[model samples]
Target: MPNKIDFGNGSIDFNIETILIKKNNPEVKKLAQFYIQLFQNPNIQIQEVDKLEFTQKNSIILGINERRDAPDRYKIQVTPYGIMVEASQVKGLFHALQSLTQLVKLNPENKAGSIRIPTVIIEDEPRFSYRGMHLDVARHFFSVDVIKQYIDLLALYKFNNFHWHLTDDQGWRIEIKKYPELTNVGATRSNTLIGHYTDRPVKYDNKEVSGYYTQEQIKEVVEYAKDRFINIIPEIEMPGHASAALAAYPYLGCTWGPYKVANTWGVFEDVLCTKDTTLNFMKDVLNEVVDLFPGKYIHIGGDECPKARWKTCINCQRNKRRFNLADEDQLQSYFIKEIEKHLYRKGKKLIGWDEILEGGLAPNATVMSWRGETGGVEAASQNHDVIMTPGSHCYFDHYQSKNPREALAIGGYTPISKVYAYEPIPANLDPKFSKFILGAQANLWTEYIEDEKKLFYMAFPRAIALSEVLWSRKEDKNYAGFLERLQFHLPWLKTQKINLTNAYAELDYTLSKSGDDMVLHFVKAPIKGKVLVEFKHNANNFTQEYPKGDSLILSNSLDLKAWYQLQDNSLCKPIHIIYNKHKAAGASIQFIEKPSPKYFSNENSIINGIAAPTNKYSGPEWLGMEGKNFEAIIDLSKSDTIDQIKFQLYNFPAAWIYPAKEIIVEASTDNLNYEVVGSWKLSPFTQERYIEPIVDLKKNKSYRYLKIKVINHGKIAEGSPGAGHTAWLFLGEITVD
Candidate 1:
């Protein structure tokens, strides 16, 4: 038998007359049929080949393959009678069948004729060990069947890692054998939030919201994934984000009091107790987890554990002292080390959020750097392996596009391009640290995410971007090419019932000079319904507000949408035009000179808000900015050179939802560019605050634009749900020197 059936090169005396699928597993017959269907070859015969005889022939075999390459490979061998493909498992046989099906093409003359597989010897393996897809069951719990379906999708994509985030402040999704109440009581929520976390006091009536996976179901899923060579890694949150756990067992908290699973998103003060009993409780949970998941790593959520509660807890204080700790921050290290030591004994390694680096990293611990690459850089520099999951790029909960209504309410906008352009490693980091960078992951925190549909809407195109990021080399990530490939996946997504926005392109409109002011408008796609048009000047800064309109219309909508002027008393009102609600619409802006000052009539107004320019100050949107490099281009060709730039920023919502970071500002000559002018760090400010920078600008030398870029240095201090800094940059009178 010959494996190659060459039709193009020359005629070959080879045939795949029969497929003998052998397995002790009872599904072998059904699987053989499936292969036959996949191959689309009705002529080929199927039979239960004997295991010993199949082994001798090196034919199709389905079982665990210990050989490294054999796990997911199809090995074809030439036989005297026909060709035989040895698959380590049924999945490999199915895949080999798919490959064989592709070799044949529909003949034009015959209408249907046998396609040919040319002589070829191909061996393939995954580029990355952990090609993974992470789902945040904490935000919105998917049923076991849904999870299995998700695994099916991962298998389709050839992804091998299924990271199940089972616990969060909002919900605990997996049942704990030792603590049955964790699912029965803790998993159920009174009511889920209806809108974005920024829209506070919008709570629903106490509706019972709940679901959990039993240990048996989890085992089934694990076996299912194993058959496909996919590893399921379960995450059990710890230390800081134990609200759900505390709700079930209040004794686990340092306060030793009740705490509800957090209704709103952001870090909470309540944390796990550092007592011996708490350690025992965690170990017991891990014991169950280790039994269920055979993956090498366990994610211990060591992120966003605020020190406020620990500073006040007597148990934490005692632990801090007992460990010879330097401060309250060190207590987290003490707690993590204890948990890591316990997991080590169970033959599992610890992986945690970058915040685990606060006190000191645990020995042999891997860091998932969510804040930014800084943590990953720090951890990698110290010889600890790091997974770069910076929230700026990897936090899928962030908005996928710049809809001010969505951005202001959801926190900030991370357009699709941003997600695609994200690089796991920062340019500033040493090249040697690259080895410590395992890969990256995207997190879909569900404070705002509620259903599987919404989850898919946010995850697909974004996840597709992340997949390419992790699988392909950095140099290969071309924005235009990626967009093209992304379009290809959209139809596939639709076929799979994924709810995704079909709008694949951004608005293309240019800014033009209109008298003293600049006019900017977009050639919008035809959208149905009343077109609630909104625009933001790269200048105006405002905090989150629900927009009020017809029905609940728009309440507290972003103020950035309205227009503003250098000497305006009234904020420009949003231009709402009624249009057929079924088709996308387009609009334009005509900036006419106003004889009198125009201002926003709303109660919240910034009169005479203009301040001197400074690198230290940022507008409201700049506060929680996190990234390694910041670049902005400000068009100053229309205005005179200025001596100062002023910015106003809102405090981190007391709710702990927004990101916090430092910022750098730059200047540019052509509208196509910019230059770094100055830098600034966020300072403590009550409510709305202002910062100013004094930079020397050449007199009468009008540059086209000014750009401000903010880089996150540390976690924002805990705040109320919507309290994070909302920065506003105001251009004061351009003092021509």
Candidate 2:
């Protein structure tokens, strides 16, 4: 202990005097060789040992115990005499070595001297059978080395499933030898989107981009992952998200001629035609995919297949009729079933996004629920295997912090805490079908993540949270303990050069209105670091630090700044929360007609004061009434001479959102009845415009109750996004002045 080195600028190195090995066993021999060369990592080398010598104090002994039943479980005992690792499987030895590697890094001893390790027995095993992490290389390609490093990280965390998202609208990331152009043309794009995918009118960057993994490289990666006890699930998108494939082979698409790999991201109208020739091409491509991946599941993407092309394609309609399919959704089921049958012949199972349940699920298909829990719930109800990867909790591409100035991300928020709280098995599910729930995974959609550093920043910590969620028992999971361990784990990650988000430094705050209406409610996390509050008292520059757990009173305006103060004194970044004391900031409001199920519980825009969600359904702050009237009652607590009330709505022709047909404002003294005060009949004026519709009353009007009713543009017609569904009336803030 006296020769111990400081925490920084030093490491502890140990020399294993001997390693035991069984000459006849292959697994033990491979593990012994790996351990012998592992010293190269710490700049130490030891000669090979032929004998299992436990008499020496510095000797390390490893033995295979096939007596255990568990698959990857292992036991390690470190004593003053020596260290012994016993495993029932080859993977267990690899995992035991990984634990040793972590111990070496986390130890406080110096690299210059030897240290004593206390005698203890440690046993570890994964809770969930399938612990997964996903990477969408199609959006932004990573070379084979990066892929192997990714697998190493997965193995380091004890995750077994590496979901390789290899295909999308933007590009294809895999090679199919039968179809040369699938990699040649399908893997390339004309130009990348200059900014975020949500950028209005969509801009473009100067250079064209392209990348693909050759079949040989992919096989090597597969072998590498196999060595680390990781299974690679190859994703080959089909029927939808196939613009890249259609770009390479136009004859396979519903529409003929001039198709190119999409430079932008989104569900496209172009899809693979449901034709015999197309099926043949799919078979050829899938043959290579099935051969390349030794894993049991082949992910055939059955997500976001816009039926617009299928509805119009003559062959699609004929196939629907011929197969007795009810609609285009059922037509998609036909396509998936065909592919499933092909994979079945190759002795592989078919897995797809929850949308595969649209028409009908294929026999022996697994569902990956990404949109929300309903798909997973439905899949489990029908007795299908389900992997819960809901976007609300598992999507890392979303902005982790509330600050708009953070890295440009796809709209929405999925912070780390939310990811940690995810429960793969829904409680409401009948206990009988629980076995079908095959755990959960975090999805790193790279639509906005263009670089490896950004990708790592987005994936780490969140992925770590996901790792614990899937690996640790529910009773053993503790957020506080996780944060404490993470603090120490970060230094080790920095040593490995893993670019972490340090997302804990991002302040997660919430705002509410105080009952008196004079003071504003502000809440923050008491996490790893300090939560510093700086505010401008009334109207001035932000230079004062407000103490924690105190009310912030609002005057003309309240400009609040909250930062996650780290131990280094240097703040990770500061986030601004400007509350300009709007008239309805602290008003009690009731939703007469609440928003639709998906957007109802979340949107707190009406009373939060901020004019949220300038775009429809773009942010969580908008109260959207899809195909229904948005009727609300704003209780002002007392009668006031209110002159006018304002409303906000966004119109994007593609998303089935439009201006309200009419807005009516009424006033009343009692709760029962109301009299009309003002009304406005309007039409959608522009595409993607945030229209502010205000209703002004007489100056003398003093009322306790204000009834605001906005009619929806019901039932979007055939051409718009989500067509035939109810057109939404997205409302952000309802301010009274």
TM-score of each predicted structure versus truth: 0.65, 0.89
lDDT of the candidates, in the order given: 0.59, 0.78
Candidate 1: count of backbone clashes, pairs at least 3 residues apart or interchain:
79
lDDT of 2: 0.78
Q: Over 4 Å off in model 2, which ranges?
A: 1-14, 35-53, 107-119, 308-331, 378-384, 511-515, 518-521, 537-542, 548-550, 570-572, 582-584, 595-605, 613-621, 668-688, 700-704, 714-725
Tens-digit lDDT track for model 2 on 1-737? 00111232232234555666655777676666666565453332333455555766566677777856786777777765667787788888877877766666565462423544445567776667888999999989988888887888888777889999999989988888888898899999989887866558789997777999999999999998987889999999888889889888899988885798888887788888998889888889899898899999999888988888878888888898899999888898999999999999999999999999998999889999998888888999998999889998988888887666678887678877788878888878889988888889888889888988888888887888888888777877677777776776677677778886665656654555567354544444445456677766755655545565645565556566777767756576676766646666777888878687766544345667666656335555677787899888888888888888888877765667777888999988887788999988775455546888889888897898888899998887786777878888887778788
Clashing pairs in 2: 11-111
lDDT tens digits, residues 1-737, model 1?
A: 11222333433234445556554555556666665564566776665655524433213433335355555555543333334555665555554543444333221122122433344433333333446677888766788877887776666555667889999887888889789989877798877666655444566656677888899999999988876557888999998777899999999988888689776667788888888889899989999999889989999898778788778888878887887999876888888998999899989989998888998889989988887778888999999988777878878777664423332225545667778788776777799877788777777766666677777787777777776666555655677777655544565567678877533343322223333332334333222212233434347644333244322221111222322211112222232211111000111111121111212121111111222223222222122222122233333335445554434333333333232255555666664566665555655552332333334444454554566553433333344442344322222222112
Which candidate tops TM-score?
Answer: 2
